[model samples]
Structure formats: C-alpha cells, structure tokens
Target: MKKTVFACDACGYETHKWMGKCPRCSGWDTIKEYKIEKEETQVHEKPLIVNDEDFIEEKIVLGMAEMDRVLGGGLVSGSSILLGGDPGIGKTTLCFEIASKMVELGHNVLYISGEESLKQLSLRKKRLNLQKPFSMLTTNRLEDILHAIRETPYNLVVIDSIQSTYNTSLPMLPGSIGQIKDVSSNLIMEMKRADMAHIFIGHVTKEGVIAGPKILEHMVDTVLYFEGDKMLPYRLLRAIKNRFGPVDEVGIFQMSKQGLISVENPSQFFVSERSNIGSGSTLFPYITGSRPIILEVQAITPKTNFSIPKRISLGYDSNRLFIIIAILEKVLGKPFFDRDVYVNVTGGMKVNETAIDLAVAASILSSYKDINIGKNTCLFGEIGLTGEVRKVVNMELRLKECGRLGINRIFCPQGVEGVDSGVAGMEIIPLKNVKELNSLAFSK
Candidate 1:
C-alpha cells in the first residue's frame, strides 16, 4: 500500500490538513490534494551520454533589440520558456510579436492557445498590423496536441498558457497541480527530442508568482516576467532565470497604438508629470534587480484620532514600510501615532530594497517638517536604525543615469569613490547620517 497527500501546485510542499495558510511557505489556499497512483511493476533508469557531434548550439535570433537582449541574444532551439504575468498585461501581444519575427526569419511556428479563437487572434493581430505566416491550434487535449506536433513538424511551438492545457488520463481537473506539471514536463521532453523550442505563457497568482506548482518553473529552462503597471503603457521584460544566457537582463517596452515600442531611454518613463509645489514629494534613484531607474516618492501625514497610525504605501512592501516607521519613531525621535502616514511611489510598480530607504525617509520628513527637496536631484541610500544613511550598490551606474537626465546633485552615503569606473564631472555629495544631509539638503 502507498500513501499520498495534497501538495501546493505553486510551491511543491506536502501537507495533510487542508487549510488556507500553508505552514511551509505561508501561502494561502494554494494547497491542493491529489491521489498518487503506484504500480507494482519495476522500471529501469536510462544512462546519460555526451558527445560534441550530438549537440548543436544554434539559437533563433529575432531582430528586435530589446527582446533579443533580454533572452540572452536569442531564443535557444529546443528550449522551453515560461512567461508569467497577470491577466491583460500584453502577454498575448508579446507572443504574437515573437511569432511574427520568427515567421520573418523563415521559420514555421505554431501557436496553440486555449484562451482565444482564431477570429479573436486575427482581430488583435490586425489591430497590431501584424502579417505573419503562422498556424494556430485551439485545443486542450494533450493527446491531440501531441498528434499535431508530430504531424505538423513546426520549427517552433508556443503554448499560450500551460494552466489551460490539461492531461486526459489524469483524474484531476485542468489547472490542478498534477495536470499542469504533467503537461509541462511532457511538452518540454518532447520539444527536446524534436529539436523545437516551446514557449509557455503562464498565469501569475495573487502572490505574484506563477500559478502552477513551483515545479513548473523548474520544468522550463528560462523564466521571464512582465514588470510595471498596465495603466502606464510601459512594461519591462525581466529574465529571472536562463540556462543559455545571463539572468537579470531587462527589456523595456511601451504598449501603444503601434503595439509595444521599445523604450530606449527607460529613465524618461519613470520621470513623468512633475509637480512644482507638493508638501512631501521627492525623487529617488531606485535600483532593484539590475534595473536602475529614478522614481518619485510622495508622503502625506494627516491628523488622525486612532491610537494606531494608519501606515499606507503604494508600490512598496508593507513590511518594509512598517520597519521604517518604527525606525523613524525610535531612532529619529519622531512622532507618528497622531497622524496617518501615507506613501506612494507614483507609478504602480513594486520596489522593495534597502536602496530607496534614504529617499523614502527624506520624502516623509519633508512632509512632516514642511520642507522642499530639489526637483532636479534624487537620493539613493539605505537608512539604518542608528540614523545612518548606508551606502548602496551600483553607485556608479546610479550616478551616470542621474547625470544623464540633468539631475544636478545626488546625495548618497559618505566614503564612496569612483573605485574604477564611475560618473565623473558631477556633484556626488556624500553624507554619513540623516542629520548631516538634512542640515544642508533642506536648508536651501
């Protein structure tokens, strides 16, 4: 006899009790139970073999500079890629763009989707002015898809989404942990054997991760994600993992009437709609995941009756906000209990790192004390519990961008030098603590 328990389709963790909160990873309602079938028959494992003649290192190259740079030069043949994002964030448009480029390269590509019909895809492509020779399949059955792949022999294959694809023999329903894994694993293995590249558009959950089990990410060779708010029309393509190329490379695109146009100077995208007189608004050079961009930070403190202050923030981690508030109260001798401290990063994008700590603190202080920070200047430094403005990483890269955008001054931690290569011929004002920077930065 064999025993089995439910596992989280997103992150593979086994559990007995069905509860909303996961004990292992603290994810809510992601746990799914499925029966594991066992067979008495024995099977043999295959041995590995390696040879230079058997491997061909040719990757498909699309001329789109932004897309190509993020994929580590180009899409590798016979590699499976996973793109995870929320609904209506241009995931489908990107796939069509890739298919169009592939067809231009004289490669036959097949786009099998379960979400839309041929007519709907045609309409969207026409809106995008896309004219490419490619085939589309509308089916959920894994067997039928396998047959199509076998007979069609397309050079490239794209699965609009893996969550919608299901396995027939499995007793679990589609989108279940078991079925999604089976489908992804089977497709990846088949692609390897057939020497075809497979692309899967995965759905992101409320927790901001892929919907399928954590294992789904493991099944694919590369994982890419769309970053930024859809309302802003600017989206960033970031590579979290890549077996063929380097990770942390980002590609910027602006969704518009002509589809996604590459934003060459991404710094301009962050600096939109400047206000002259705001009680508590300032700029911050936020760098996270190798992305260097300057963003506006605004803070407002309103009188409140509640004993516990209402601490609210947008596009920033709540826990990080809490910690900083506590630090402000204890270390800096500030009172926040009598007011509601609200913060917003302007653009609806998540930025979590210690790098923006100084900027955030400055914005809040500016509001609390009724001061003004220079509009043409941005600050990037980490704030410690002892009121020290700690130095951040990639100072050179940060200053270079700041200087390029007509930003006159940058206030960072003290003791930072060019080291080797850095932004020169600019005022890189260095300070040790909040009090030191405040004495001069706000005095003007």
Candidate 2:
C-alpha cells in the first residue's frame, strides 16, 4: 500500500495532511508531505543467549588527547558521530587532521566531501601540510558513496557535510528534511554493516543548532558540537550526546596555521591574559564535563544616560545576567538599575553553570564600586533570591584547579560536605550569603 503523510520538520510529527503550524513544535509551515510505501516482512531470526565476553567493543584512538577526551576516550568502531559547527569554525580542518592521524596509525580511512571538489580537498591538504595519505571521494551521490564504502574494508569514513549529499531516487534537493533523513539512514546502515567508524560533518542553523531534521542527531551514536568564536583562536569541542562515553565532556583546541592544535592546559590558557589589577574582572572555577576550569568573568556597570539601563552580556546568559543584577539590587542594595551592566567570560568561552552566579555578582559589584577582588582570589557559588549563597558540586576539583594556578584565596558556599575549607594550602573564605560577598569584595 502506498500512503501520503505530512511530517513536521522540527520534531518529526506526522499527520495525514499538511498544516500551517505544527501542533507538536509550534513551528509554522514546517509540515511537509511525503509518500510512504508499505511492505510486509517475515520474521526469521531467533533470539540467542550471548555472554558478555562474546563481544568486546573496540576503539580507534586518534592519538589526539583533546579529540579523544571529547569522544569518550576514542572513536567507537561502527559508531556514527555527527559534528556540527558554524562555518569557518574549523570543522573540515579538524576532520582532516583526524584523518591524517588515522592514516599515520595505519588505519584505512576514507575522506568523503560533498561540498568540495577533489582539487579543493587536495589544496586544503597541502595547505594544512598533512603528511599522511588517505582515500578521498568528492561526489555527493549517496548511492555512489555507499557503493564505495561497501567495496572497501575501511576502518573509518569521514563525510564532510551530510547536508550536501543526496539520494537521486528521492524527489527532493539535498539538505531538504526528507533528503537528509533518508541519506543519513542509508549511510548509517552501511557504516554499521561494515563495522567501521563514521564521522558526519553537519552544518549548524543560525540558531546554533544542527540543521536538517532533529532525528539526525537522534540517529547518531554521538553528537559533538565544535564551538568557538570565529574571531578567537581557541575552539571547544563538546560532547552533547554520547552513547559510549560521558556526556558534556569538552576538548579544547587552538586554531593555528598548522590547523587545530590541542590545548594541553586550558585553565592556564584561558586566564593567561588576565590583568592583575582590574576592577570589573574576577576569577571563577567553572566545571565543564568532568573537569574544572578557571575562567575570568568580567562585568562593567556604567551609569546609563538612557532612562532604561541596558543589560548586555557575551559568552554568559543575558537573562541570568538580569537576574543576577536584580538580586544584587535587592539584596546588596546596589544601584545597578541605573547602570548599564555588561558581563563577559574572557577568552570567548561560554559558561552555562549557575555555580558562576556569585562570581558574576562580585564582578558587577566590583565594577559598580571600582573595587578590585584581587587577581589571586577565586570565587564560585550559586546565589538564591534571598541573598544566600548556595553550594555547588565538585568543590574539591574546583579548588585543586585554583591551587594549581597559584590562586591563594577562595570564596565558596559555607559548610560544603566532605571538603575541607583549607585545601591546596589556599585560604578558603566560606560565604553564607551575598552580603558576605559584598563585604569581601569591597572591604579589600
């Protein structure tokens, strides 16, 4: 039987007919029609009892510490990974570097590019000075790419932008919702059958999400976002979803002429440019994945001439900035309502943890009062609406990173369990509330 249905591109909701707005995701005009061919299948396989030792999962180590760390140690064989990032964010460069390393490790790797010609790929390889040789294919035809994969016993396959690939049998253009879904399905099936690792490069939407259907992310074994400010040299590869490893793991890399170089000590690299005497800057220990990193949170509160004060933030949430400002205004009695508050995380790093709440408050207060919170001091704690400082996770880990950086003073929530106040020979100042934060920042 052949039937027609309409599907929502955002959430994959299907209906018998098209609708202007999707009831599931509320996206306007996202529903598109597609025909389905139904066929009957006979069950033939029987369930067999297998021991745990029957299958030993294998990993292909890329020999790059930063890349491996984000990939949960190494790329799991037969797993499909989707890597999304903004254009010129070094997505292709990172993949090429990984391919070269795999070749050096004596792995049969295939570099497929739908977006670039073979000559362009060659030019990039020469420009990046990749010494190792690997197989290269430049066609976007899904059938041809699958045929090549089926013919070769490859250890790894790199698809340079899945959106550019298409199946000719499909009556749609490449990058369309239907085309992306079907192409990814066929490619992933072949990858698993060959038991080889696959890395799919995907383009990100303007909203910073992977383009195409949301199901593409769900279909992959791992989802990694290669993120960094295009203006900055540093890039952060973060694992958003990983079936084989821990989620939220971050790998740091620096963009250079040689390509993406892995950053060994991100803590020192992020704070290397900090000024010793800055009123609006404060050091904060932020946890990304399982590791603790020290980041500089900067805020400037200048009196605004406009009636409504401006609240702007970069690399930090603006709404959270508004809440932090409101808390300071109500709790600490700071006149932030009249000042234009601006907050930023140095080194183009984006921080989402609320553990940085206290640091942000301190920086804003320091800027408002023109006080320096000492460059050697670090502060981290969540702030409540009642002006009380709350505890956060991984206190010891945060403290250790602070100690390693030679920071001697620390401010954190009071009475953290299983953690001594004095750690790493640094003076730990326990803070119970935001009032203590105000006194600590301004008293010095």
Candidate 3:
C-alpha cells in the first residue's frame, strides 16, 4: 500500500498529517509530504557469532599521510564517508587528489560527478597534473549511477555531491530532504553489499552544517568537515564523527597552484609570522586528534567611544568569550567595560577546547596592561567561574610540543603529573588561579 507522510526537514520528525510547524523541531513550514510504498519482506537469514581473528578487515591506504591520519590510518572497505564544506573550499579538489592517488596505486576507482561536466573534470585534472587515468561518469540520474557502479568492479567510488543527484520516482526537486534521504540510503546499501569504499561530498548550509537532514551524518561511518577561510590558503579537514577512529582529529593542508599539499609541521606554520615583542599575542599548545599544535591567541582591548564595549571574536566562540570576560572582571579586577575586546586564533583556526581558557585570559590581560609575555612562553589551562585554574588533558603532550618549539616558560595548572620530570630547559610555572596571572604574567 502507498501512503503519504509529512516529515520535518530539519530533524526528520515524521507524522501522518501535515502541519504548519514541526512539532518536534518547532521549525515553521519545514514539513514536507512524501509517499512511501511498503514492499514484501523476505525471510531473515540466520546469524552466527564469529571470532575476531576469523574476520579480518581490509583497509586501502591512499598514500597521503595527512588524509590517512584523518581516516584513522586508512579507509575501511564497505564504509561510507560523508564530507561537507563550503563552496570552492577545496572539497572537490581534495577528493580529486584522493582519487588520483588511489589510481596511481592501481586500484579500480570510479568518479561520479552530478554537478560537473566531463570537460570540467578534465580541465581540473590537467590543472592538477593528474596523469593517471580513472573512470569518470557525468550524470545526475540515480538509476544510471547505481547501474554503472553495480556493473563495474570498482574498489572505490566518489560521488561529487549527493544533493545534485535525484530519483525519477520522487516528484520533489533534487537536493530536497526526501531526495537526499532516499539517494544516500540507496547508495550506502549498495556500497555495503558490494564491499566497496565510497566517499560522498555534501553541500553545507550558510551556518556551516551539512545541508541535509541531520540523519545523513548519522547514516555514514565517518563524517568530516572541510573548514578554512576562502581568503586564506590553509584548510583543515576535521573528523566530527568516526566509528573507526578518534573524533575531533584534524588534518592540516596548504592549498597551492598544483593541489592540496599536506603540512608536515603545522605548529611552525601557524606561528611562523608571529612577532616576539607583541603584547597582545600569547602562545598556546592545542591538541587536535593525536598531534599537538602550537597556536597563537591574539587579543586587543582598545578604549571604545560607544557606550557598549564591543565583544568581537574570530575563530573563537563568542559566548565563551563573554563568559571569560565576565570571569576576568569579577576575579582579576580588570575593567574591560570601557574597552572593545577582540580575540582571534591566528592561522584561521577555530578552537573550542576549554584548555584555551587560560591563554585567552592571559592574552587579554597582556593587551590591556601593555605587557609582553614573551614569544618563548606558552600556557594552557581551564578557568572556572570561581577564578580557579583547572587542569587539562594530555598535559604531557602539550608540554612536549612547547619544548620542541623552543618555548622555555610554561604556565599551567598546579600539580600537573609530568611537571616533576619536566622537559629539558623548560620552566614549568604552576598557576593555582586566575588571580595569580596578574603577578606572574605582568609582574606589577
């Protein structure tokens, strides 16, 4: 029997009748009707428990160290990965590079593009100097794409975009919620059955989230977000959800005339343009994935003529900034009411970890009082509402990275485990609370 049901586009909340607003998500007019035809079910196959040693999973190494690292060493066969990013942010370029690299390793790879023409793909290939040839299909029809994949014996398949592809049976236009859900479900089932590895490139909304129902992220084995400023050359590929690897792992790459090149030393690259005597700049070690990266947190507090001092931030959370500012005012007796505070994480990187709390507070104080904290000094700790400095995870890793970068002085929470046997030539200063920052960093 065929039946029609209305589903919310935002959260996939479905109901039998249509409503002006989604009851689940409270999104107005986000409900759309879609027909479903129930089909006959087949007999279920018997399940058997198998030993771990009996089943060996195979992985395809793409030969790119950064890409492999983000994929938890390599791509597992029969797994589907969803990658979302802004337009022209190198999502396609990065996929093309991955396809080219796989072809060089003599793997049967197929590149399906619903958005670009065959000529356009060729031009990009020439520009990237990709000499190795791979299978290419330029079509938006879901039937044709599925037929091509099933007919060929491909080890890997790349879908340029899921939004552009549509099924003819669906009356809705391409990129609709129904179409995305149906297309991705079918493609994933097919890939799993054939034991093929696939990568789906998805479009992101204006708010920088994947431009489909949140269900799409849950459907894939791994979800990666390609983030970077369009004006800048650096791009960060971060794993948001991964069943096979650790989440929040980031792979750094530098865009060049040829293609995306992996950054070997991201810590050095991020702080390469830093000035030594800058009052507003403070060095902080951040851990993204398994690697520790040294980042420069810059803050400037200039007196504002307006009644409300602007609290502006770039690459750092604005709400968190407000909280930090309130804590500094209540705890440190710093008068930021008359100044416009600006905080930025250099290198176009976004930091969400609470470990950056102390560094941000220090940078703000440094700029306000016009004190130089020195480029060789680094700090990382979480600041509580009561002015206490909380300890952070991976303290040893963060400290080692600072030591390797030639940073001699460190400010961290008191009683860090590795402080007793500290890094050679590094002075580890333990801070008990935000109140100590004034005398330690500023020496008033």
Candidate 4:
C-alpha cells in the first residue's frame, strides 16, 4: 500500500495513522489525514502586470456618513461587508436607511430579503414614514438572485440574511456551513464579475455571535456589528473589522416609529438628565468606542444576601467593578467589602477605555462616601494599584470636547505635562490619588 500521512483538518496535529481523537486542537471526530497525488503542470498563465491607471475603477458612495466612514470613505467596487446583529436591534432599519440614501443618489440597490416579503418590507418602510423608492426583491434561492443581479445593472445588492437564503445547487439548508461557504463564495465571484457592491446580512446567535462558520467573517472585506441595548430604542453600528476605517469607529442611531435617526453628539444624549449633587450617582465622561460621552455611574453598597457578596456591574465588567471597589477601599478610605456592590453606567454603553477608570473609581467612592463630584465637572483617567492615577490618551482633545460642550471643570490624571493652563482656559484639576478627588468632591 502506497499512502502518505497528513494533519487533521480540525486539529493541526500530524498523524501517521488517522485516529478518532485530535491531540492538538481537541476537535472531536475531526482527524482525517490524506495523501496528495502528484500531477503534472499543464498551463503557464502570465500574471497581469498592474498599473495605477490601467483600469478605470468606479466606486459607489453609500451616502451615510457613518456607513461610508466604516467602509473606508466609500464602497470599493465588488467588495462585500457582513452585517450582523441581534433581532429587532434596528439592523434592517439601518439597512433600509442605507438603501434609501443610495437610491436618492441615483444608485440602483437590490434589497433581497428572505426574512421578509416585498409587502412586509414596504410595511416596515411605511411605518418608518419613508417615501424613497428602490428595488426590493424577495427570494430565497441564491442562484435566482444571482441571475437577477446579472440581468440587471445594479450598483449594489444587499442580502437581508445569508442564513435564510438557500442555494438550490447545495444539498444542505441555507444556514449550514457548507451552504454559507458555497453561497458566499459564489456571490463574491459574481459580484466581482459584475463589479457590484454587496452587503450580506447575517443573523447572530443568542450569545451575540454571528451564526454560521467563522470563516464567513474572514471572507468578507468588512464586518459591521449593530450593537446596542435592545431594551432601549437606540442602536450603534460598530465596525469590528474594517479594511479602510478604524475598527473602533461607531455610529449611533435611535429607532423610533419613524426609523433610525442619527444621534448627533451622543455624549449629550447620554448624560443630560443627571441630577446634580446626588448620593450614589456621579457624572463623568466615558470613552465609548473612541467617542467621549458623559455618563452617570451609580454604585450601591447594600447588605449582602450571600456569603460572598455579589458584585453586579451593568454595562461593564463585574471584575472591574470589584477591582475599583478594592482600590477605593484601600486608597480612598471607602468601605464596601461586606456589602453587595452594584455599579451601573447609564445609557447602556459599555466603556473599557482606560480613561474612564478614574471616573468610575470616583463615582463608586462618591456613592460610598456620600460626596458629590460636582455638577459641571467631568473626570477621566486610568488608576494603578499603587493609587497613582495614570494619564490617558488624547487628554487635550477630551478636555477640548468637554469645554466645547460647556463642561466647566475637568479632572485629569496627574503628570499631564505640556497642557498649559488657559490653552483652552478650562480648569484642569489634576489628581494623583482617589484621596485628592475625595477631598475635592467633599470640599467646599
């Protein structure tokens, strides 16, 4: 017997003999090694020598500022983006918004929705009060949709969901890995041949992950996530992967009966109704997705119901909340060990920026110490275990934004050197420890 060995497909472990178990990647029943048969080369194809001006390339502008920014200023011809989000989070609304804008700019858009019928799509637009007209196609067959795109001179195509659309050529159902791979690959090839911009909508799992094979995301030019609180009508279009724009870029939209409207300056939208000089609540600017937004953080220390008092953090991490509590207890003389600590960042935006660390610490202690961090003052910085507040990125820019938005006082991390006073004439209160902030919050 003449045979050669190979590695497992799921696991990278090499196998002299194929086994049931994979040693490296630990994937079950995935170890299948095979030998390659030798073949002779027949064709010698010359590579196409490239020049910048060789081909006349025309791109489509999607007509949404945030959407265009995510796609590197405009949609590259024949590029595809995967749009994934939870159900009822205004993903379709944003898609319709994009289509409407494109139609207004004289671009033909094909919105193929396997999830909704033409009448249903129209009903959504009616509810949104939008009168803009565009082509709407309802089909589940991938081959039929490809034929329609080929027959027409459409500038863009949007598949409402890749999981719901099936290819008749494939044996499996629509959402199967095989079908997704085959359909996506075929769609990409067709889009390239036709020179069309495509956006593939993907349904996500309950755990906030995109359904289907992970390779589907890698196969696309960009991946857009519509992430926000489902309870609230507001939604955020987040770019987790961008071939052109910064990955952390975001677009805030509020979903109403009328449709998704951009929330300009979401900083004000988040922290507007904050009560001044309140216990258990403090307002500070939290950098969310590279945008500095002021938010109210409330922390409550109540009697524990369990032996290990629960630390509940809404819109942030529980471990981070506890670490802030520990730092506050040790360095700021605020005690919350035996009590159940509950922390919340209002507006339902998760902020992991190192800049918000100082503000979070201050808010927790402000609630515990019965002090206020002042009404018109916003704070942000990183905190070390040694109680030394560390400086954050774009201090001057944050301060400028705050000042432009009428923030009176700014608390920055100490050693913000070269930020001369009155450069913006904003009061820059630098603090080294929680104690300094504690003194200022309680000081007359």
Candidate 5:
C-alpha cells in the first residue's frame, strides 16, 4: 500500500504527513491529501515550430483610460485576467461596461454567467442601458460554455464567476480547490490555444483574499482586485499581478445609479469638502498608480477615563498609527499613553504608503496641542524611528497634485529641493526630521 501526499491549497506546500496547520503559509486546515495513480508512457510527436510573424504584439484597447491604465494599456490577446472582489462591489458593472465598449468597437464578446439567469442578466443590461451586440450565455455546465465559445467567433470571453461553473464529469464540488484548479487550467489552456482573451470573475474570502486555490491567481496572466467601501461611492481597481503591465497601477471609479463612472479628477472629488485650517486636519498628497491625489488626514486625541485608552483607526493601519504615536512620544517628550487617538483618511481610501507618515504625525500632534496646521500647506514624507524624515518616490508628482489643489506650502524630504513646483507661487519647504513639524503647528 502507498501513502498519499498532502498539499497546502493556499501556498501549495506539500508534505508526506498531514498536519492540523500548514507550517509554510500558517493556514489552518488548508492541507488536503489526494491519491496519485501511475500512468503508462505514451508516444511523443515532434511539434511544428511557428514563425515570429505569427505572434502579434498589438493589444486591444479597453477604451476606458482608467481600466487601460490598470491593464497596462488594454487587454492582451490570449491573456487570462482574474478579477476578484466582494459581492455587489461593482465587478459585474465594470465587466459589462468593458463588454459594451468592446462590442461597440466591432469586437465580438461572449459573456457567460453561471450565477444569474438570462432574464436577470437582461434586466441588468437594460438598467445599464447597454445596447451593444455582444452575446450572453447563462449556463453552469463547463462543457456547454466551452462548446459555445468554440462555435462562436468571439474575440473576448467573460466568465462571470468561475466558481459557479462546474464540470459534471468530475465528482468534486464546483468551488472545491481541486475542481477550481482543474476548471481554471482547462479554460486557460482553451483560451491560449484559441488565441482569445478571457476574463474570470472570482469571489473573495472574508479575509479579502481571492477564494479557491491560491494557484487560481497564478494560473492567470493578470490578477485584479476591485476594492472599495460599499458605504462610499468611490471604487478602486488595482492589479496586484500583471505579466504584461505595471502591477502598481490602479483605476478609480465612482458608482452611480447608471453604472460605474471613471473618476477623472480624483483630487477634487476627495478634497472637495476638506476641513479648513484646524486642529487634527492635515492635507497629504497620495500617489495612486501613476497619478497623484491630495487627501486629508484627520486625527483626534481626546482624554480618556478608561484605564486602557482606545486606539481607533479608519482607512489607515491601526498598528502603524500606534507606531507613529510611539515615535512622537519618544521624539517630542510628549506622552499620549492616557489619551484615546483616532485616525482617519477622509476619502474612504486606504493609504499604506510610508510617505503619509509626516501628515499623520502632524495631524495627531495638532490635535494633542489643540493647534491647527495651515490649510494651504500639504506634506508627505516617511518618518524613521530616529525622527529623521525620508524621501519619497515621485515627489514632483505629489507637489504637482498639491499645486492643482491650490496648496502653496509643501513640506517634504530634503532631497526634493530641485523639483519644479508645477503650481506657480508654490513654496517647497524641506524637513530633515519629525521635530521640525512643530514649527508648522498653530498655537492653541
């Protein structure tokens, strides 16, 4: 008798013995054992070589500038894109928008939905007011969908959730790790063989990671995540993995009654209602993808009666906030151990960039001291543990975004002295350490 090997589905860590938790990825109960059978060797044939002229480098432009930016300048032929997001987070709307655009450009598109029926899809199409000639197929059988794509002359195929589609021949469930891996591999091979573009909509787990086997992301050419707070109208499309384009690129969209609309000027949209020069408010220019947008960072420090003060952070990393507070106390000899501090990024956008450190520190100190930072001033720089300020990438872009928002004084790292401020009459103030931020703080 032969023993079975267990593999971690999350990270594909394999072992001869099964454990309660995977040591590699620290994922509990993610290891599953499977049987492997020996197969006989078959004859191999020499494959024909193709010429260089057979490969086309030109990409299909998605028409939407924001989406194209995230996709590295449009959709590539024979590429597989996996888009994952929370339910009702505008994934379907964005897919439909893309299909409509492709159809309008005379490209045939086939949209297959395994979750929604034909009538339900028609209602959504009507609501979106899309009159494009793209074909739609509502089916859960993987064989039927594959047959339809083979018979149709479609340039692009959209599978609205590969989890819902199943292989009837396989005994495994539709969304099981083994089933998902098999299905995705088959679809990717089919699309690649046919030299057609395909996009798979994927569901995400509660932890905000894409569901199914981790290899599902690896099997695709691009992995995009549609992220945003449902309470807010703004949505962001980010490509975490892209073989053909920049992975750091992000697309901004605003949900409306009609559908998802591109947010061309995100700076204005984010800072339209920015607070005036007041305590606890600081303007920070954040770079998303290649574009810079000015955002407001707000913090409030109130005396707490509880023995253990609460540290609440919204749209920012709570752990980072605590670290920043500790740095402030160490540098400035100010103790906030007895105070409750709350930090928030105003636009419902999660900012994890180290450049926003200065802004966050300033906002917290301004609130503690009951002083206001200047409304015309904007700042961005990474703060080290020694209280020294560090230079950030694309300083010129951040300054330009601030200039567009009429921000005059900008505090940045020392190396940014030579950046030409795109906004006239703008003053570039350089800071060497976090202690210098005290000079900009308003008096109580």
Candidate 6:
C-alpha cells in the first residue's frame, strides 16, 4: 500500500489533509502532498572500521590562525562541514583562501565548482593572487564528482556550493529540496568512507536559514554561517554546530581589495567609532566562545503615537528588549507603555547571552531619561524577574577585556565571590537590584 501525507515544505509539518496555510509554520500555500513508497531491501553488514593504530586523530592546519580558531584548532580528516551565507558575502573568497592555504602546506587539494565555470574560477584565482597549484573541476554531475573524488589523491576537497549540484538520476532540478538532500547525503557518505575532509557551501534562504530540509544541518559534522552586510568591510564566521570544536565559535575578518583578512583585535574594531559620552549608549564586554570582545549597546525611546508601543531591536532580541523594558517600568516606576523603543548592538554582531542584560537595561534607561552613564564605564549582569541582578559566568574574562580596552568602572551583579577588585586595573561595582542602577539617570 502507498502512504500519502500532506506536508508543509517550509517546516515539514505533516497532515493527512491539505490546507491553505500551515498551522505550525504559518506558511501560505506551502503545503504539498508527497507519497512514501515502501520497498523491501536486503540489509548489509556494517562497513569496515579503522583500528586505533591505523587511524590518526590529527587535525590539519589551514595556515590562517583565525580560520583554525573557528574550526577548533584545524580541520579534521574525514570531516564534513556545511557553510551557508548570502550572495557575495565572501563565502567563496574564504573557501579559496582555505584551498590556497591547504595547498601551501604541501597538501593536495581538490576544488569542485558547480556554480562557477572554469573561466570564472580562473579570473577569481588571478584576482585573489593564488599562487599555489591545486586541482579543479567544474561540473554538477554527482557521479562524475564522486568518480573524481575516488581517483584524486587529495587531503581536502571543497564543493563551491551544494545547491548548484544535482544527481541526474533524480527527477527534480538542481537546488530543489530532493536534490540537495540526496546529493549532500551521498557526498557525506563518500567522504567518510574515503577518509577525506570535505567542505560544502550552501545557500541561505531569505529567512537566513540554510536552503533545503532541516536534516541537511544534522548530517554534517560542522555547520558554519558567514554573516556580514555586503556593504560593510567586516565579515563574521560563526559556527552554530560543531562536532569537533566548541559551538558558537566566531572569527572576524576585514574585507579588503586583497580579499578577506583576519582582524587581530576584534574589540578595537567593534567599538572604535563609539561615542565617548552619550545617552542610550553603553560599552559592553561580550564573550563569544573563549574570546571576549567589547561591543556597544545603544537604545532609543520616543513617545509612540500608536496604541501599542513598537519595540524594535537590531542584532538583539526584540522579546528580550520588551522584557527589559517591562522590568524597568515595574521596578523603577518608569513607564514605557507609550514609547517606541529601539535597541542595537554595534559592529553588526548579534549577541544572545544573558550576561549583556544589565548593559541593555542601562542603555534603555539612559535613553529614556536622556542621561549619559559617564565615559570609561562598562556593565554586564543578568536581571531577574524580581528586580535582582545576577552574576554571569566568566566574570574575570569580561572584566579583563574591559581593562585591556582602558575601561575603568565596571558594574556587575552582587554575590559574585573570589573576584579581585583590581584584577584588570578596573573597579568592579556590585549592584543588588535594578533600582540601584537608577542613579545612572540624569536629573531633570
């Protein structure tokens, strides 16, 4: 018997009946009916496993410290990584840098381009000034690519983009959900069997999610996202999932005409243009993985004409902003019900840690009261629903970064013990509740 089910293509929500909109994802006209064909097949024995003596758990250095930092020291053999980013966001450029660096290390590398032709790749190579010799193939045929993989003696292989490749046996066109699922699954299996490292570039949807089924992210050993405005000079590589390294690892790069270069001092790059003394602006030390960088949090509040005040956040959570606003209104007797509030994290970096909660609250309060909290001051702490400020993890690292950046005054939550007051040439101020921060506001 054939099994049929209607599913939402966007989120994979299934139902026995079709509907105009998906109840789970709210996608309009995105539901499609697909049939599940059942067939019997013989089960095979497990493949040969490598012995401890034969297998090496070594990592291959990519020559770039920043790239290596993000990959948890370096790329591992037989590892599969999926990289996603918007168009012209320096995804291809960074991959070329990897290929060039790998080749420079006296390792053979194979580059398969399904998107760009030979001429286009050659032009890019010349523009990038890549001198190291490496193998290259421009084809979308999965079998041919697999055959090349089997024949080539390569330590590293890079597929320019998985969306551009398709298996001719599949009836669907390239980049379709079916083709991406089938092609990536096959390539991953082959790479694992061959014990060669492979990196696949994936395209992201308008919603900033990787294209194809959600399972695509689960099959890879690592999932990295290249983020930055195309108009900006900086690009950020963030690892959302890493089986070999720590997740949430980030690498900063400055895009120049010579290509992408690593930013040695990310803290300086983030707050270089910050105003010294401004209301609705506060310096914040945010920890991304093991590295701590200083970011500026800015907020603005204006009286709204609508019945429901609008809360807008850029590079921050809107819901969290609203929660902070509500906390201030309840604790400090400040009313934001009739105001339009906006919050932004400078440097185009998105921070989701609760350690920046106190900084966010301070910025919002400063904006509402039009008060500057003075210069050379930084803040970090988590705010509780009961108006209490809670201590965050890695307090020493956060304070050390602030001290390195010449920040003198630091406000943190109370009850944190074993902390030296002069650890970083900065004075640590402990606060018990949100009410204590009210002194930061300017008096009318």
Per-model TM values vs. the true structure: 0.84, 0.89, 0.90, 0.85, 0.89, 0.88
Better of 3 and 6 by TM-score: 3
Stretches of candidate 2 off by over 4 Å are 1-48, 416-425
Instruction: Say which candidate scores most in lDDT.
Output: 3
lDDT of 1 by residue, 378-431 (tens): 888888877788877888778877877888777888766643224455667788
**Order of candidates by TM-score, top first?**
3, 2, 5, 6, 4, 1
Q: Write the per-residue lDDT of candidate 2 for residues 4-92, one digit (tens) a residue.
A: 87877666677887799989779898788877777767657689999999988988788899999999889888889999999999999
Better of 4 and 5 by TM-score: 5
- Candidate 5 per-residue lDDT, tens place, 1-444, comes to 444678776665678898989898798998888765444676576888999998777688978888999999998978899999999999889999999999998888999999898898889988988888679999878899889978976788999998888877554567766668778898898888888889999999999999888888888999999999899998999999999999888788999988989888888888888655578998999987788988899999999888999899987888888889999999888898799999999877788799999999989988999887778888899999889999999999899888888889888999887788777788888998888877645444
Q: Which runs of model 6 end up more than 4 angstroms from their true locations?
A: 1-54, 275-277, 421-425, 440-444
Candidate 4 ranges beyond 4 A from true positions:
1-46, 55-61, 275-277, 288-290, 420-425
Candidate scoring better on lDDT of 2 and 6: 2
Candidate 4, residues 34-109, lDDT tens digits: the string is 5644446565668888999987755567666666755667777677889999887877888888888878888888
Residue pairs with colliding backbones in model 5 are none
What CA RMSD would you report for each candidate?
5.4, 3.9, 3.6, 5.4, 4.6, 4.8
Minimal lDDT window, size 10, model 6: 416-425
Give the least accurate 10-residue stretch of model 2, judged by summed lDDT: 416-425
Compose the digit string of candidate 3's lDDT tens values, residues 317-344: 9998999999999987887889999999
- On lDDT, who's better, 1 or 3? 3
Per-residue lDDT of 33 in model 4: 54
Instruction: Report clashes for each candidate as comma-separated counts.
Output: 3, 0, 0, 0, 0, 0
lDDT per model, in order?
Answer: 0.80, 0.88, 0.89, 0.77, 0.87, 0.87
Off by over 4 Å in 3: 1-51, 417-423
Cα error of candidate 3 at position 275, Å: 3.3
lDDT of 6 by residue, 1-444 (tens): 567778676655668998999898798998887777656676687888878898667799887878898999999988999999998898889999999998898888999998898888888988988998788899988998999998876788999899889888554558877778889999999888888899999999999999988899999999999999888899999998999899877999999888889997999998888756579999889999999999999999999988998899998887888788889989989989889998999888899899888999998888888888877889999999878999898888887888888888888987655675445456677889888877633455
Worst 10 residues of 3 by lDDT: 416-425
